[model samples]
Target: MAGLVRWDGFSADPRRTEVAGVRASDGDRETAVEALREAYADGRLDRTEFDRRSQAALSATLLGEFAPLLQDLEAPAPAALSVRDEAVRRYRRETRDARNAVLTVGTMTTGIWGATSVFNGDVYFFWPIFPILGVGVGWLMQVVNRGQRIEHHERRIARRLGRRRDADREDDGDA
Candidate 1:
């Protein structure tokens, strides 16, 4: 008896007004259509207007088809999250190579020059190069390490964004 209720007006019960298992909200297609039908039955809308709108709504097959009515629903534009990932990868590599080069050069230079400098303590200028080298190497290593750390952080952010994008693509593909 409840399912065969009178068609004079829309039902107040939430269960009777469901669309795709989602409760029919005020602006929902099912509720709106039911209300329109009720209005027409009550002589609120003429035959011409009701038929025109019902046809328009039913004819919309895709989300874009309802573009005019749902102007507020804006689809996200494509972005280049991979570019940030590439940049992060490149900077990380550069920093790593720069750091290795500094270490290699410092070790080799110190081994060969240190022996010679110890033998010639008379040359005050030669000893100064060791302190200078130490400072220079330390500063360069610090810079490279700092840059690598920053790049590592950027890579993490890029990876997260990339995963979200890939997930979105997968969802779209399935749909």
Candidate 2:
């Protein structure tokens, strides 16, 4: 028949001209990233080239893939300085809060231990040594935890900056 075929049965009829892995919606980003990774692994791209292409793909949305779609959903100008300032301020505040909390805990524990040793007539053990050890251990743990937290924050910021840089490149390229 020359007319459009209507499916009346449940049996599947697969078409041969299908592009197997190319999806046409926003949901396709993950699939496309996986495909790009596979392509890179297959020796189709060198490290630098693969990284460039992967970053490009990661930063682009399905809507940004075509010129028409690109024109329709143009992003606003980035507030780079504002973002950087806010990030810095936030990091400082977080670090300060952590430092204060850790020091407070260490101070309170040492004071309580010192008072107990003095009141119980065991001031011999209240010498500088064990209190220093206790405070040192507390401070060490706090610094380690703070380091982890700061590292995590840094990674998050780096990812955001990486994405923003790609966006800036795209904007410049389009201009």
Candidate 3:
């Protein structure tokens, strides 16, 4: 018969022998324990299973052993992707708002200029051009600085995430 297959912690593929053979460190073991604690706190694991896994994690001696512990649990997402997504979202929103404001102000000024020209019985020398030009220039600047603005926005998001991560670590430490 073929070799019996088992659901290893990381995946079904047993070819991870290379990584599994590497020795685990104390910090790695503690990290696994933390993951288990989080899983248990989130109600992903029952008391009995959480206790079992927690013990196993504490005793694990290979880095590969930690993989199986995480397989059934959802892990946190990559920070870069989340931060990029947020920055893009913010950029799009701000660009849209700026565009809308430019359009709205231009339309209102044009309408006023038309009304004033009619009341004066002649063309009023296109006075709406100044306001439109100013708003248009402001929006043009925004568009031109899109890359820098997005980076600045991303930095802000990352800082906020850092603070939240620190807070979570404190909470986790307490737990």
Best by lDDT: 3
Candidate 2, residues 1-175: lDDT per residue as tens digits? Answer: 1111111110111121232223334434443454454445444556786576656645654423322211122222334335445445445555655566657766776688788887987864444555456656655665567656556666765775676577669769999
Order of candidate numbers by lDDT, starting with the best:
3, 1, 2
Report the lDDT tens digits of candidate 1 across residue range 1-175. 1221112222233223232233333334443454445445445567897686556546544322332332222222234335555456445554656666666766776666777777876433444456556656755765657756666757755774576577669769999
Q: Kindly report which residue stretches of model 3 are placed more than 4 angstroms away from their true locations once superposed.
A: 1-81
User: All candidates' TM-scores?
Assistant: 0.27, 0.31, 0.52
Candidate with best TM-score:
3
| Model 3 Cα shift for residue 103 (angstroms) | 0.4
What's the lDDT of the predicted structure labeled candidate 2? 0.48
For residue 19, give model 2's deviation from the true position in Å: 33
Using TM-score as the measure, name the better of candidate 2 and candidate 3. 3
By summed lDDT, which 10 consecutive residues of candidate 1 come out lowest?
1-10
Q: In candidate 1, residue 44 scores what lDDT?
A: 53
lDDT of each candidate versus the true structure: 0.49, 0.48, 0.71
Which residue runs does candidate 2 get wrong by more than 4 Å?
1-81, 124-155, 158-175
Clashes of 3: 2
